[model samples]
Target: MRRESGRIPRRSFALLVLVLGTLTATGPLATDLYLPAFPDIARELDAPQAQIQLTLTAIMLGLSLGQLVIGPLSDAVGRRRPLLVGFALFTVASFACALVPSAPALVALRFVQGVAGASGAVIARAVVRDVFEGDEAARFFSRLMLVTGLAPLLGPVLGAQLLRFGPWQVSFVLLGAVSLVSLVVVFFALPETLPGSVRRPFRVVSLARTVWSLVRDVRFVGPALTLGLAFAMMFTYVSSFSFVSQSQFGASQQAFALMFGINTAGLMAGTQVNGFLIGRVDTSRRLAAGLCGALLAVGVLGALALGGVSGPWALVALTSVFCVMMFSVGFVLPNATTLAISSQSPAVAGTASALMGSLQFALGGGLSSLAGWTASGEASLASMAVVMGSVGLLAGGVFAVSARWAVRPAS
Candidate 1:
């Protein structure tokens, strides 16, 4: 919130970190926690499996659209009001989801829940920029990731436990309760991050200008593309994992959750590496390294999949490599985010953050959708691996070109 840009009290900083981390945690938790319940949900609602998967796409659409609206609004008005409003909406939507009887109704409610859930993620990054800049911002984000990454690791496990003991509704109830608690905490503890001096007019023309400028900026685009590609890779895995595990490998839901946890563990490891390296290396170099590493790992995984090597040990080996690629994700996301926000005017930080997030979600959503289309029989896993690897290679190529252009002397 509106604290002076000086030495923040350690306790206050810790609280701020907690709130920011919690805000960032919602989407990943929402996506991953319910994954274990997907097959069950399809059976209970008598919905086709493809239709059940579309619910995830619906949620992602809402998340992308919501940020487009909330980001600029937060810049125009203030961060606190929009965030609190969003949390309130999220709390209500989660309950609505829990109570919905039909698959279509639940899908509709999940879209609303996603819209509400988007605020924390969009605002959390803006908040980071509100207080810190450059490397400091990178460090703060890496720390936030430590907390946020835990959600993916823990969410599925928790969801598996819930589904094992209670009905699927129990998961939604848990989400609603978590939202309620976050709302109360924010109301009492979270302060305004953007001050009045930095506020911008919320006019449509002004918002359009901000978006135009952001899209045109090479510095912003480079990192944003990197982040988008990395996320796309991850989402490809998420979108196809159920089909892969069930049809291809015949793994139980519990086993699949455990595998998900193992993959998420790679994300945690990457975040730790990012925290260690952010302060030591140049951000651009760190990003390049990450992109390259992801490209290589994804390439190997794709090759393995394409070679028709389908066994338990082979699957685990390939998945493990993909999981390790997640570590590089840490190096890419925060750096790209920092570059985008730092390149923008402070008055339009909300708009900048919003566009960055919106594009990331839109790209990931598109990739996931593409993966869904490629879901033919058990070979969907191989298709997913190819898509992810291709995207990563493309991103690495962009980063390489950017570096060359940036370093070139006047001709």
Candidate 2:
């Protein structure tokens, strides 16, 4: 989709990305900020572990469903209204979560928070699609990646800090405050990117048809599957790393967080490399290099796991390989997203973005859960690696096959 003719200043474009990136980061921020408080929440609410865990489940389910609803709605309504409403609701829900007396109430409110938070993740991409085309969108996505990618990984770390000063409720209070700031920013900074001229009316049957057509398009599904599965790989690694590092490898909490911080930095580094290579290197080659790097790292990881390796060397090996894998992923996500959203017509940008976002949330959750359950009790580095390797292969395979039917893999 071509942007409107007037050239947007670089400073303004960067500001726009920052605003949109924060919106995109909110879902993950809200999802993970309360994670460190789980133990306290369970104890205070007098709920079983299973019941308390439902709150996490509730938010994820809400995020997945919320994207499906809000993305298409934004296509019909225009970006500004749905987005502001979502930001407001998320802020309200964050405060409400802090005040909930019962575990069930918290779960319900978290669902609302998640649903509201979806506006940021969904429309941010649609807005990028609206405002930037081709190479510029890819570059912008790399920048957005820095915020959205880091927030959830950073959330628990920040939550652990909040616990030092106050009870678990402080996490929600902080989330509310941050989101309130986000709401204020959106009020003033973010404009309606989707104008009336290109807006699609909200019609159920028509929506279904447009979405179905998008699904049937090889171009959208290919990169989207690549994006979803790549995310599944990253999410699996992120969600499982703590358990694998500490439970199986016996790393201390500080040590694990340190290692986690380093690996996460690798992810950011990969994006920077990708950003540098955007115009110089072929996009498909960058994606291939990422997939190949992840696949190789995970293969080694799986072998170490299945071979019953252990001790400090195993720990060192795993951490090093994770850095490589995460670095590779920096290249994958932005390019994949660009391919998926940018290929679609401007009219369906919101729907397309939402569908991809939903898949990302759903697949990331589902695949990570699968790795956990498939591991039986207490996930190990090896099991996590196996899941990562399998997912990497699937992502690579899907992209390789699908790209043949439509666009070149960039190489």
Candidate 3:
């Protein structure tokens, strides 16, 4: 039973968070670790730089579609089975990505890797929802964000070092090892969160109805859109910034890594602050505060871009603004997740988590790629600013429009 006290016997809670955080982090680690290797992969594979960005798009598509399938699948069968199966696939795909002979092949493997990695994200959220609610769930998610934030903080640096000493493939090997270790942890440390008594058998009609009901509910829809749109802003920055920094500002690989890590640290700081404010602030108010901060930073980014800022000063300016912007993102992510999941019944938490994640990756990955494509098939610092600002405005609008129905839908 979930304790409203939000206690899990300190040591056990620490272990549980570690295990779930590791699971939750797999996709991001996969995504972020390979970022520094983009130029190398493009050069070695004889592909255009623009085409290389497509690989990011493909994995995101897989992540979106995978959550749609695995979330409901876990609801019907169980989180344990789907998680194990997904991790196993992730390990295999990670290794296979190391051996692909061409960009197209690598993209195909990345899509599979993304699909597999998504099982971890969807399952982690469902597990949290299964065991916690209200303030307790929100606190746990803040902790979870701190864990996930480490991926971008460390991934690019590790990837750049690997690329410097070895090859781009070495990064994929690391991902494979991480998944293999995660498999063992899942089997030993994590237990099934979804109970058999509440599991509805996987059925097409019932699945459709459950999804429809969730989709139309503003309580769930508002926070989920809020989360997804904000993520689109973040993910576009994460996926495309290497090109922006290197191609536009003349940054080296190591410099880019450090830059990425610093911004990520800002994000973790935001989450840490959110954790401290758990009882002091309500979710909607905090979320609104975050949107305001992010939109304000987005304005700074737009001014710099529109002014045609370039060279080293532009680099310093962009990094500072990005750090401040991502700091606010830390607040947006965890609180939005808690609201959406808490609004759902545990019986369908898997589905609810899945829908949120699907929209998150799909919107996050899909629309931003167009920015790169429109910029003559290459991402630039200016284009990143423009696209993110547009999306941030849209997210703010959604949150404002949906404020009336923030409470859970009547069952």
What's the true lDDT of residue 316 in model 2? 80
Clashes of each: 4, 0, 0
The RMSD (Cα, Å) of candidate 1 is 2.2
Pairs of colliding residues, candidate 3: none
lDDT of 1 by residue, 63-110 (tens): 888999999999988888888999999999988887877899988987
lDDT of 3 at 299: 94
Which candidate number has the best lDDT? Answer: 3
Clashes of 3: 0
Q: In terms of TM-score, how similar is model 1 to the real structure?
A: 0.94
- The candidate scoring highest on TM-score is 3
Q: Each candidate: what lDDT?
A: 0.78, 0.82, 0.89
lDDT of 3 by residue, 114-193 (tens): 89989999999998988888988899999988888887799999999999789999999999999999999999888777
Model 3 reaches what TM-score against the true structure?
A: 0.96
TM-score of each: 0.94, 0.90, 0.96
Off by over 4 Å in 3: 1-11, 407-411
